[model samples]
Target: MIAIAIKNLSYHYPDRTPALLDINLQVKRGLKTAILGMNGSGKTTLLYHLNGVIPVESGEVQVFGTPVVKERITEVRRMVGLLFDNPDNQLFSTTLRNDIAFGPRNLRLEPALVHRKVEEAMQLLSIEDLADRPPYCLSLGQKKRAAIAGLISMEPQVLVFDEPFSGLDPALGRQFRELLDELVSGGCTLVYSTHDVDLAYAWADEVVLMHSGRVLKSGPVDLLCDEKTMMRANLPVPLLGRLFQGWNEKPRTLEEALNLMGSTGLAKGKRLQA
Candidate 1:
């Protein structure tokens, strides 16, 4: 299923500066898609259009075959949950539980059902321990998780994130990745924008490279291996891509790379004995 489709999409700022120019794209359902671009490349602008946060000046956007028009804006938002680059923008309630519960409550669900949804979201994020703490006092990583829980509570079919790992340490980043994996395993379509080429290369099932408010290229993660495309997008070649350039086999993570090296060494030792 086509989860999202953008056609001839263009947007501009209040001063008439173009933010997105004639963009066309389609995202498949249940795929982990990474939008790769540098700062000021219109990544966030495109994301805003996904959830109707920004009005579409010209062109059309469809979520699950429903056109994103004024009449359907509310429905679009309900289908696509967005997480801002900064967690503070989304975490406004005092307590963590309140913050996560805010969405379902607004939907006017029954009190008991809202409570159940909030608890389930917190557990899914493994943030049950922080339920009683104030969102304002939580660490950056914790705040991000809480912000995600807030969206999860909404039960949106698709989740969109902007620069999700901006301030996370390696350990916390791994945790976030695991959370994302769980979401996808549960049939959620995931879309996120990032400038980190390495992470995009290693993590995404599909990649879209944007430059100067236009999509330069979009295809499978192997697109990152094209040095010319990476250079054109002003992105550095991912380390693993550069290391295993000509080899048909590529390792997507550190553990896989280590295993590949060990296997290669063992094969070489056997060859020497023969």
Candidate 2:
């Protein structure tokens, strides 16, 4: 089933600056898709249409076959949860617990049900201990987890994230990826935008390369293996592809690269002595 369909999409800023132009794309349900581009490439503008965050000015955006129009905007938002780049923008409650509970409470669920939902989301994001603290008092990573917990409480079928990992150290980033994996495992479709080629190559099921308000290409992760296309997009080839450029087998992930190295005896005598 198709989770998202965007056709003939175009957008312009109020000042007459073009943001997106003639975009046509489709994402399958339960797949992880990465929008790849440099800054100002219209990736974020296109994502905002998924949940009607930005009104469709010139084209159509469908979420799971439902049109994202003002008449059904609430339904679209219910089906698609968007995570802003800044957790502060998503969180506006006094305490972390309140922030996490906001979504369910707004849905008018029974109080007990809302509590259960909040509890489950907190546990899922491992943010239970930070519940009573104020959002402003928590670290950036903690605030991110709290914001995500709130979204998880909504149980949206599709999660739209704009630069979800913009400011995290390596450990926190891995934790976030693990959380995303858990969501995908539970049948949620994931669509996120990122400028990091390595992250997109290693994590996404597919890649949509955008440039100058247009889609350069959209296909399997292997599409990133083409150095020429990466260059044309003005983005670097994924680090993995660069590291193994001439090899017949190009591995996209670290494990795959290690396996390739083992198979080719590249690591035979390179082990560091203890």
Candidate 3:
């Protein structure tokens, strides 16, 4: 089912240079979608519109079938959780554990429920080790995971992540990807924006390429993240992407790549091929 919908959406800054124009999009439950764009491409601006942080100058946005208006804005925002790139912006509690529990506590869930939720979220994000640490003391990666844990505690149906990988180390990027996969399995819808074509291609079921505040293309990752499409989007498919370009096989996940290579027998038996 469609958890979020945006139709004919457009936005403009106070400077009024146009942030988005005629944007139509839908996010289904339990699906992972990547919104890819370079700087000044309106990725974050559009994300703001999704959760109703920025009112649309023209268009309609509905979250979980809740039409966004002043009266219903809080409802919409509650239904859609947002994890900004910087965890500092989202994590407000004195400690990681408190930050994780803060959301459910605000919702008035039972104390037991709140504790369970926080523990589950922290464990799921694999940051149980950092649960008691101060939010400001965490490394960039741990802070990001804590931010995600905070969002998870809220248990929103749809999540909008803005540049979750920015400033993250390579290992952290992969760890975040695993968390995203787990979130999708748990039936949380995701729409994350990033400038990295490679990670977007690896993790996203659908890639939406935006440029000049317009959607240049939207399609399967393999189709839109190809060489030609990358060139059109002014991005590059990673070295692995270059290796797997075309040839009838689609490698969506890391495991799929290894399986494909082994299944296709990329290396022949030359006596030393054990």
| Candidate with the greatest TM-score versus the true structure | 2
* Candidate 1: C-alpha RMSD after superposition: 2.7
Clashes per candidate (backbone, < 3 Å): 0, 0, 0
- Candidate 2 Cα misplacement greater than 4 A, ranges: 271-274
Deviation of model 2 at 192, angstroms: 0.5
In candidate 3, stretches whose alpha carbon ends up further than 4 angstroms from where it belongs are 170-172, 238-241, 269-274
lDDT of 2 by residue, 1-274 (tens): 8999999999998898999999999998898999999889998889888988889989899998999999999899999999987899888889999998999998899999999999999997788899999999988878888888899899999999988888776887898799889889888999999988899999999999999999999999989988888888999888898899888888888999999888887776577442
Residue pairs with colliding backbones in model 2 are none
| Model 2 vs. true fold: TM | 0.94
CA shift at 108, candidate 3, in angstroms?
Answer: 0.9
Q: Tell me which residue pairs clash in candidate 1.
A: none
User: Candidates 1 and 3: which is better by lDDT?
Assistant: 1
lDDT of 1: 0.91
Candidate 3: tens digits of C-alpha lDDT, residues 1-274: 9887889988888997888989988877788889987788889988888777788688898887888767787788778888886778888778899999988988889999999999998888789998888899988888988998888889888889999888777886777778778778988888999877767777788778888898877876775546676677777776567777765886766788877877777634332576
Name the TM-score of candidate 3.
0.88
Which scores better on TM-score, 1 or 2? 2
Instruction: State the lDDT at 161 in candidate 2.
Output: 90
